[model samples]
Target chain A: MDKQYSEDSRQFVPETMSNMRFAVLVLGHGEMGRSMEHLLSGRHALTFWERNLEDGSENIPLEQAAAQKDFVIFALPALPHAELAERIQAHISDHCICLSIAKGMDEQGRTPAAVLGGVLGPAGRFGMIYGPMIAEEVRAGHPGFAELGTTQSDVYERTRELFAGAPLYLRHNTDVIGVSWAVILKNVYVPLLGAAEEAGLGDNARGFLATAALEEMARIIESRGGRRETAYSLAGLGDLVTTATSTGSHHRQVGRDLVHCAPGDTCGTGMNVHSEGIHSLNMVQRFGLLDLESFPLLRLVRDIVNEPRDVAAKFRPFLDASFADAASRNTRD
Target chain B: MDKQYSEDSRQFVPETMSNMRFAVLVLGHGEMGRSMEHLLSGRHALTFWERNLEDGSENIPLEQAAAQKDFVIFALPALPHAELAERIQAHISDHCICLSIAKGMDEQGRTPAAVLGGVLGPAGRFGMIYGPMIAEEVRAGHPGFAELGTTQSDVYERTRELFAGAPLYLRHNTDVIGVSWAVILKNVYVPLLGAAEEAGLGDNARGFLATAALEEMARIIESRGGRRETAYSLAGLGDLVTTATSTGSHHRQVGRDLVHCAPGDTCGTGMNVHSEGIHSLNMVQRFGLLDLESFPLLRLVRDIVNEPRDVAAKFRPFLDASFADAASRNTRD
Candidate 1:
């Protein structure tokens, strides 16, 4: 540690834990990655790399960047996560902190944690950052909240301390599996909120879906050995509500478009729109990690997204089926 | 059972268990009561009564209505529930089903269930109908969902059967205390969402608040011997999101207004608008049912509503304190 010059006060200060600057490597130059770079550049020794390297001056080789940093943030989409981790595997120090901000499933329906386990192996100190902090909002200095889910307590502490002076707020929990599933599944549920909006169900439907979605998510998480309460935390219920209601979200747009589009049709309004929820549904179905029978709402949303025609008609059967199940449960009890 | 005339077909049908109609007494003529009447009138023999007798023809004497009816639906505000229940208690049939649709704490912080117990004793069969069913939406024949919380299985079954052909969907649960507390406490948390919106915290804040509010409500409910999962159900999280985000909600409006109003101000823009959340806070403070120490968000919302001022300033401390607690917890773990 060395004396660091403060941009605000224009004076050198002796290094303290709060002001300790780490050599940080941020993967990708996307919106989220840039936002992280902006937030961390002034306080830390920051380096960035993008696959294409549009600006070659600031870019470094992936291996070089991975070997030199105290922290590696995966800001790329989940689809490329495993590949990227594998490419940089040999270069990453065992003690280097690895965190992911990705909130989607890979094509194989592997969560970021699972992908990391395959890529980084058990030797690396790793975790993830997931919650409701949108990149633009974070860039604007709006107060943001996130959860750090990792198996290692020291990893959580180091990650927590890394963002100590930033506008972001972080909470640490050891339920990595639970938090990972919550973040991954929220992408699958947000589009249903959009479908509810398209159906003119009003605020009441939004409220109903909000709770119902969390309960359904809880069942799926529990089936996978994740805690049910995690679905009620920032990573699950919080992120679901936020993403579902987000004004410019792609998944919500897909829902609105799916309502108007014919069966087996891509939305005419966008040239190549890819909804994360649609991708998630495909991956979840492909992997079959959890029983689909218990998740009526998820099945309904998946059906709607799959056919994307006469959404209301598609939804009614789901309501009938779920209520029928409830009625049977009532009788059994 | 005799042959019953079907309203839709105008033909007589042989009696079945499902078609057995109850003598239903509706206690209010408000939007909710009207909606219920619209839903149940065709299926059952319906009676109406109001203390003021705004409509003379339909209004029956309180004693007559109470004695003859097999079901008494309380659609009035929580403030009037106890007194109304008491006035009609002696005249009520021993086996009459008593149901409340009110979702607020009375002046003494007593939930409608507690008030019913105090007024009706153990003589009357009691339960509550609560969920995300907004009156206007239900009136429009929208699919609605609710939880019927009762002690008796027969009561739950009968209530479920009463709405068998209607758009209202019912689920039975034996956690009457938990469901009652969830519905009551939701009103107290809805304002926090409004406050978050007023602060321009974006969907992230909404997500953060949604999870935080439910967690706080769960703690309170659990402290009072109510089940924590009840807060995640239709009665709690569902209704809270609906009410908090509802465009026409007075409590949400109060939140936005409180942000702009001066200390000790009643939003000059509106005339004598009373918010249920404000009333709820006062009552909760009066009752001291749950420890307020764990509920910083509730306290911040209460303080803002009690004396509308710089809401952002008031909320920042709460954010700091909670994050500090989370960080310390992370380290301790």
Candidate 2:
């Protein structure tokens, strides 16, 4: 290996590796792509691929990059994952691991895990990285946490070595389905927090709404063949807190915008750009993936999004019904 | 029944009892006491007793106030609960329900539920109300959510009617022990959030800490004969989110103050008046209530509270260890 030069100094330094450094190809030139570069640039040989050729510089053929890399990180949005995975699957190395940071379902209501798994032919080479990793924070050098869901132990070990010194931390879980569903489902709960804030329901209501959402998420995950405990892990509760409470959260802004608009107003300011939350919400409903009647909070979020008129008044009745239902459930238990 | 007039009006109105109106005695005249008055004053016949006699007006004998009341709400701090419960236990009506909103253990590491149950003697009338009922928010007429934990069905029903028209909502749980421990244990997790913020750890760190704290809290609650589900309910996760994330939380401030102060500095600005989080930390440690080895987050909070030096550096290792332990545990499973 040749010595490398520091970007600022241009001074040659001896090549160093405490552990093996893999070739990592980051797919996308967006915020997450840049953040991944920040964490992985010094530690590994890195390459960047922009789907749209936005920069028109450092352009490499997708097949060439895919052929040489030891790992492909699908840092792009969920919409492009399936197509991209299919495009690169044939050229990629046999041992190459694919990890997705996408937290939304495609138009077909298939999660990124399903998309990648389908394209990768069940070799168990694909996994998901999901949790409270806000891209800007990772770029700013603050610690990030996530659950790495995969069936392969080698993938987990390679991932651990790939970003050992970076502030991002990972906990491995074998339940790819659970982590995928949890991270995706958490986005659906974000707008409700914004709605609660816009409605002036106060902190108590926020707390109540969060607990109710988690309960519903756990049930839905369980129904979909995922572990209930995964709903309480970093992929679920942790990501929900970060997205729901962060001032920069787009989904939360969607909720606030919904509250301000008049009845039947489909395009509030936040609705102009469809967020992952809105996409996930529509996908879940469109596919009839969950029984709406069983999940009151999820149902309430759907109702508020569809009609949005008198959104504030909708919360009280929903809360009352939730407590009453919980009371009855406890009675039976 | 007699006709009543609104507080602002001198005009009289016909007597109203959509349900039974009970005579209630509220102990303490602090912030919480006033907040409870705001909720209960209009609906029921109400009286108040102040332990410190901060206000000389409306003085009433303790026994006299306890004798005729159908409900006694202990709105004071945890320290005075046992003594007051004993003093009023004899004079209170046999059918009266004593519901405490205290969220800390007494000096002996006994929960408010245990103290009240010990004094009230097994007719199962004593109960607990706990969740995100911030006193200021309650006084402002925003809704509050709490779990009403009592073995008696009648106690649950009466307590429900007591706050039906008010903004406070209750879900009934039969585990007084679970609710009490959950509410108390939640305090132990608050200061760590403040510390995270002060350390510039960002939102991702905050999310991870919260999930970690909750995981530890559920384990501790279950180990102490309480239900694990209660830790994820309003009393545990709900209250934790409210207190940890709220700008006005004293415990969070304590964590921030600890980060600012030097090692061995016993009192920072936030530590001047020992918050309930600190008290609970001390009680749990002093009584050997939990095995510190099993709960790293709780132990980290205790260590930071005791030795305030280099507080910022503590979090990364703790997080790394936690995820590593979790990964190994998952492997074994």
Give the DockQ of candidate 1. Answer: 0.41
lDDT of each: 0.75, 0.80
Off by over 4 Å in 1: A1-17, A53-59, A267-273, B1-17, B53-59, B267-273
- lDDT tens string, model 1, B223-247? 8887888888889888887877777
What is the CA-based DockQ of model 2?
A: 0.44
DockQ scores of the candidates:
0.41, 0.44
Q: How many residue pairs clash in each candidate?
A: 0, 0
Clashes counted in candidate 2 amount to 0
Clashing pairs in 1: none
Candidate 1 lDDT at B28 equals 91
Q: Which 10 successive residues of model 2 chain B have the least lDDT summed?
A: B8-17
Model 2 Cα lDDT, one tens digit per residue, B1-333? 012112211111111124768899998878889988977877799888885455554467888789988899999888888888888888988889998998988889889999999999988487799999888766666677888889887788778878756767788888778888888878878888888788667788788888988888888888989888888899989998888877777767878888887655665334635778778778888999888998888878877777777776676568657767766776676
Q: What is the C-alpha RMSD of each candidate to the true structure, in Å?
A: 6.0, 5.5
